[model samples]
Target: MKTIKHFLIALMSIAAFTACEKDGDLITLSGLEQSELMATESTVVLTQETSAEHALSLTWTTSTLTVSDPTMLAPNVLSTTLQVSASEDFSGTIQESVESSLSHTYTVAQLNTIAKNLGATPDAATPVYFRLEASVGANMNPVYSNMITVNITTYEIDMSIGFILNSDQEATGATLYSADSDGEYVGFMGATAWYSFFLEEGDGTVWGNDAVSGTAFVTSSEDGSWNCWFPGQGGCYYVDFNTNSQNWSALWIPTLTVSGDISGELTFDRPNVKWTLPFTATSTTMTIQVSGTGNQYNNATGTDDEAAIDTPVAFAQNGSYVELVSQAGDITVTVPQAGDYTLTIDLSDPTAWTVEAVEGSEEPVVVNPNVYLPGVDDGISGNWTFDNALPLYNEENLAYAGVVNVNSLWGYTINIERDNWSDNYLLDSGDATSGTLVFQGNTNIPAPTAGLYLIDVSLNGLTYNLTALGNEIWVVGLDDQWNFNMPLTATATAGEYSGQITFAGASPWGFQIHLDSSWNRYFGGSSGSLHYRGSNITDDASLTAGTYTMTVNLIAGTYSITQ
Candidate 1:
């Protein structure tokens, strides 16, 4: 004889549980008062004397099912339960079945026990939430009443402390707990870039930066003190706030590179605050080493993120999402496969940073093209129209010369970067024939006439020689590798000629005038005198290393150097 009781019990609750109220069907909750559970005593103070006394009574009414047959009685198929919680939302609750009852009475001792179990502190009045749950046949189709609150004061005991922290004082914030109730509260807070905040003790005391300059000080309980802040990137930090000391501390983690057992270095994404390196693992898995400077223990001072950490690294470790420690840490995030992958270290958040491994092939390496100066040759451009410029001649040593096709008389500027206005060069003195050159100088030689010409400019000695290409006077001795040369315009008297020259060079300077590019015939003599190769003429006393005006009538044998 196989028993049928077991089978009937198993299928009783959900047995075709449907709304087909034909002859004798269950029509649950047809006419019930739509309200919350009600408590007779809304508040109570539990004591040893009142331990046995009734503290509170909770009652709720719910209809099981309604049917058309008036002669039939409602079946006792519905079950009710009593739920009590110390939270308004009842995020955590304690449930006790009331069988088929409609009301439950709690004694002082029983109510006190429930409150303490729900984390309510003794000797303080804490609000507890209560509601009734009605269901038919093994908790199917459960219906709940509105929640009610009952404030109860229990006996005394030790409870941990907590402090509220906020980005804005009057705005939303979170709480950090102190297990020992010692004023020091700790919690995980997301500190973002420039996330200035404050902390408030349970007694309504506010704490913040002490407003001191260059100090790791904090305000004891000042409402108008400077705002508090995180020292470094402020990514997710395991933060600690000490209400007594008024100071806070967290590891100062500086931005670092991600390397070790990888192909190359990763580039940092400034906008996203992350570093991503893509590569395939060499073996079964990949290892990453993140090593950098950080504060080990002491709170960072003004502008010194890790003045105290005072080491290459304070703390670190392996595994995903490792809390940054204030000691030497060896961190290696997981990369299961050895194939292609892109590893990323995200530090975008001011509160914390994260490491992630993404699957991918090798990303293309970008090569930035080189930037070159504009090319200019005298014939095509820069002939004098500002269309092109005369730069250093064939990368020569300050010998700026260009052959230009000129229809009329025109002047040109010279610069390494052809178009750079700040560095452009011009004649500082004299006419188109010859003169001194100065940086940003605004003078140009109005050459006697313009045809195909060679504009040779040397800014080293601040001089330029505009020669008619055919007639050129090679003035030597200005520079060892160069010449103190300038073109001399002829006079109607032929051998008796006059010209002007401006000279500047190192100390103990002298000069020799050559008639042609050849060193065959030269004149070396002091001012107002002339000599045919008679010992080199020198101005080591007053004329050397100084700017002077030199005017000479070579044939008349009269020259003057005016300082």
Candidate 2:
């Protein structure tokens, strides 16, 4: 009987332990209340002058929870997060979390930076919503505190018409320098004048009463003005002006000069002309007066007083200047009369320095003739036959251009000649179709492929280009006004053609390609790949009102559209 009673006692102990384990695994809180959050200050004004000592503080009441099974409420770690958002819905929010904190503090500067990062306008009051989130174990649901609203006013200095330097005497001479609230110097180093500020709408009250030499100052007016006067010295200077207090200061900046070879040559007189030193900051061109006796060759302008030469003129030194003369050279230039004359020389172009008689100029000057391109081989004729050669038109960019007809099976090369056979130029290496033209002595440049092409040749630079004629491949459709004349030409490459076209009023715009400006042979299809000599194909894809790149491959018989 004692043993039977012991077994019953053991059964009772096991039942109690199992009951405890079940309760511990499934614990629940019967009543939970959201925390109350409040800010020490509902509205705060922040400025650049505000410091971290004065910060915005927020405090929240601790949350209360009623556990259904108090024994299961053992010590549990919970996370408390403070979230700040631009909208009340908590969209686009920034959060800070801690293990357990009833209060949080943010400096005025920190809050201002946050507001700015949130795209708040400067000098404006913006509302920010703040709330708290409390989270516990996986079995428990998260809780949130009541949201609090904060109005933050951020201050920004008004710099629309701030400090300016009155350097140049002209009415619009002032150069504006933006200043901070404390009136610190921060700007680019350049030359500008102070008078430019006068054009602004503000009154004279902006100028300071007391002036500090070489310093910027603000006037005592209600709408004050800032001004700085640079000293007589020519150098870089840093100037600053305080908007709150009308005070300004200037700091001189030292500059180091490094000497190098002068770019162009100059002359003041015959034989002593070439002055290779750097020109003055005022101007790159210089002028000098020349005087000679009467009877200086009666050629309207006196012959002895002025002269031109084929070779570069020599320099002759005077008091502190020099004169340029073409004597002992190709051509001699003369002046109109025996009276003193002013000659202006510009050395901007080292190869061709312009010399003109500004004071007493009479006639225009003459120069050398430019080169030209005769033409390319059409595969039907010999390379240098002038009879069938197409004359290239000079287009001034060191380039000569012309168009020629070509065949598919036979390729041709370019033959460049200057007037006669004395100087013949050709590509040293590279296919004339699409590679660098390294000029070889009297070598021929073979064409990249056979097609009607527009050829451009640069003889001096040894470069040439062949583009397939656009007129050979026409694009027609309602999108392009159904104009058979609209065509896409081959780019720098051989068989690929590209051009941009707009689909405006046409709905579901479509187009077809024609070969050699004729409808006799054309391409049209809807399967990305083009069909030769097919019926008019409607585009499976629709086009809107926008520009698109239309590329066609003649060899592959394919086309593509890209916006």
Candidate 3:
């Protein structure tokens, strides 16, 4: 016969029972919050002191009793059952909420394992409270203890700085750290951020991130700030704050200024202060002298302005000086050694000096008009109207007075300077206008120095033999009236040559070779021929005073006459 034995128990505060025979030894049990069944804590506070992020463990110790050994305590046969529940309140939620009511019997080994897995050592304070639970069949119960508290702390840092959104090179900023009493910064770590600046005048900026550390401040996007730094210390620098969520504090770096003047403490013997000047003159003679306040007064070789002009000017240490005498025009000087020097010149009256006398303190005296004496030519003087556009013909070689008439088609050598100019006719460098006009010798004559000249003409490749035509002079005039002497001459021979004789464009008509005395003129044809093109020849009426060449063929020609 089977007898039902009611085993009374508790599971999480609920009462229950299990049926079993007295001799069956089924070991019916209730859940146990504490393995040995003794508790001291009734509440737990999971304070901020818990460094561990997960759950905490609770435990207790007590001697157990068995039904069979009513007088003996069964520490050897300790049996246990457990139930668990979670709560938001720090109070005994394990009793208020019955998460699990079922009870499972635990062997002595199992009981110790449960306590060990819950982080319960022999006597660890384990300052968290959990309800003691017991179960038998469906019955549940909870046991409570006094309150226990735990302390835990967390770490946080604050960082602050300005954000440079636009990476402009001209815009500069700095990251500054708050300094301690000893000038050291607290928690000052490394930093990194991107930066960019212009590579060229109009190019896109180049950029990269840079990190640095110190109690000191750093410039971000350092640019255009007038500040001076040690070489290679400026430009642009990016920063990276190596900490988490911390802002990097910064400031726009201000620029600095430096100033000083060059002085003459720099002596010639110590270290030379070199200087030079460039110029051109009309005559072969000129004068140079250096005279100023400080080093200019020094006595030097080339510095003494005297006569017998020096080829390449030189100056020695001395007092200030001046150019008393020197070459006429421009002089170029290249200093091999260091020194100070000055230059000057005195230009002789150019061919015919035009004096625009403004009434001064003393009414300017007007000198007598001088006659133009061309060497080896008939001396003539008149108010000739001169064309300023002709190529450079050193007028110094031919002096003219009066209204100089310059009417002809002639290539110009154009150059203008405040002083006596030279034959500078070629176009300036990099000038594409009118292209380049090269002479027979590849000479680029821009504007020639202002002057007067005798125009010499050559036919074919040979200059005409002036003596062959009876020592008689023929004046080639670009006028139908034959009124003016066109400063023309000819030396001739015969060969294959191509050239254009340029006359002043002011002269309107074609060319006319007039016989000063009488002579035969020969041109394009067979031997001893006088050929005249229809376009070039007109009425020879103006030759009423001289002999002329006939257009018809000359039959037995070799003839010469003498008085």
Candidate 4:
């Protein structure tokens, strides 16, 4: 902190700055500048060698306390805003506020950003200014520290860099940052296309593609650099680059599919590095035959096709789980006959990628879930009260089904409505698709991907499967139109659905749910439950429809409509 002479208030007054402590007296803090801030270092040099360490730290004594009365408690300002700037007056610095903190540490990346914002060139010696401002209780005025100047020799390369973007030679507003200053930088960007781009350092250093059409992520401070393929086919991609490792990858896959013995596609969960497929094994031996399609890309060289499964994603048994390997070496293991399973492929660690098969029960196992679908229609965001939970009563076939919307951060479960979880439910394996269902397990079954899925379980088979479903479902058999009509749009929450329907005629009516615009798949059921192509859902005892709302949750395979 600068000397107190300029603040027009002596630092010694802080010791006696408390108010009169009267109930009616305004609790005012002493002055706008009442504390001395100390800096650990004033002159520093920033280099990649020292990037991981703090360049300097700013700390200040707490502000004077305020109290309405002697008997009342006094609390000092608990928040502080640290301002750094190139101009001594601080007209150009970025404002960073920290609560319940008294100190601010500077890292290379932060300083680098400030340097650019202040018009300081990388590797140039410059003076950066810092100050702290805070407000105490009821003090309309914020107390600020005396401005302090720090001389810093910026690193040659801006710790925070930007991309030139698809067609530009100059860096766009797309800046990426290294959280640890250890060379790993990650940033998210949405592009109509992200196939080409160049990395631009603060000092105007251009890092781009090498020859051979720039197919690799090979970048060095030498000759073969300028602009390169950022390693993705295109979409909003999560890009991670490490200057230390000189490697980078951008992955974005909106959907995935599994064919052959198991068939269907599922949504790709990018953050979790996983995609799931639920199906049943026809025999003890089966081969997963297919590839991934739709919007996706991989910028990692020689692995761009990784986005599409490349036709060689054969998973082999490896101890407790399975892993993707060359199709020629695809190994087989004993799979429970007619095993219902959820197949998951996780690529969080590109190397050692694993395809785990979470198995449920097989035919004749006699394992039944208390409820076919017990879930939170609003989603897992609130406390779930398995109220009116549906039970599996199809003893002849013992097949139960429903749609579950696991939301973004949670999974789903199959249980009944009872005071206790154990007594109300029968089995679950947090994310199990095939193996034996744990009896009365409290753990929820995690969706291979956190979203809407069609869950199918067979009691006698003791097997369960989850098929990913889109939100384009429609309402049929209403409005005297039974064709692919009346679209029930999807809500922000997957599987949880909503729409409106009008009946030109009569009371007791009926409707059916269509998976898509086609009649190839539709559902029919009664009493708040759904059935695949079963019968017309017309069991409502009293129904006089004018224009009613339709609420459907595929995850729970339930629906309701009313004015």
Best by lDDT: 4
TM-score for each of the candidates: 0.31, 0.25, 0.15, 0.32
Ranking by TM-score: 4, 1, 2, 3
Give the Cα-based TM-score of candidate 1 against the true structure: 0.31
Please give the lDDT score at residue 327 for candidate 1. 46
lDDT of 1 by residue, 423-489 (tens): 6556677775677777776654344464434455665567766544333344456533345355554
User: Regarding TM-score, does 1 or 3 come out ahead?
Assistant: 1
Candidate 4 C-alpha lDDT tens digits along 199-311: 65544445654332223555554555544553323333446666666656654444445665556874344334455666667677755543433332334433244343322
Expressed as tens digits, the lDDT of each residue in 110-192 for candidate 2 is 67666666667777789988888875444456688999888888655333333332322112322333323233323212221
Model 3 misplacement above 4 A: 1-58, 62-65, 69-128, 143-148, 151-563
Highest TM-score scorer: 4
Please report how far candidate 4 places residue 183 from its true position, in Å.
21
Weakest lDDT window of 10 consecutive positions for candidate 4: 1-10
**Alpha-carbon runs more than 4 Å astray in model 2:** 1-26, 29-32, 65-73, 138-141, 157-563
Whole-model lDDT values for every prediction: 0.53, 0.45, 0.24, 0.55
RMSD of each: 35.4, 24.9, 44.9, 18.8
RMSD over all Cα atoms, model 1: 35.4
Evaluate candidate 4 by giving its C-alpha RMSD to the native, one decimal: 18.8
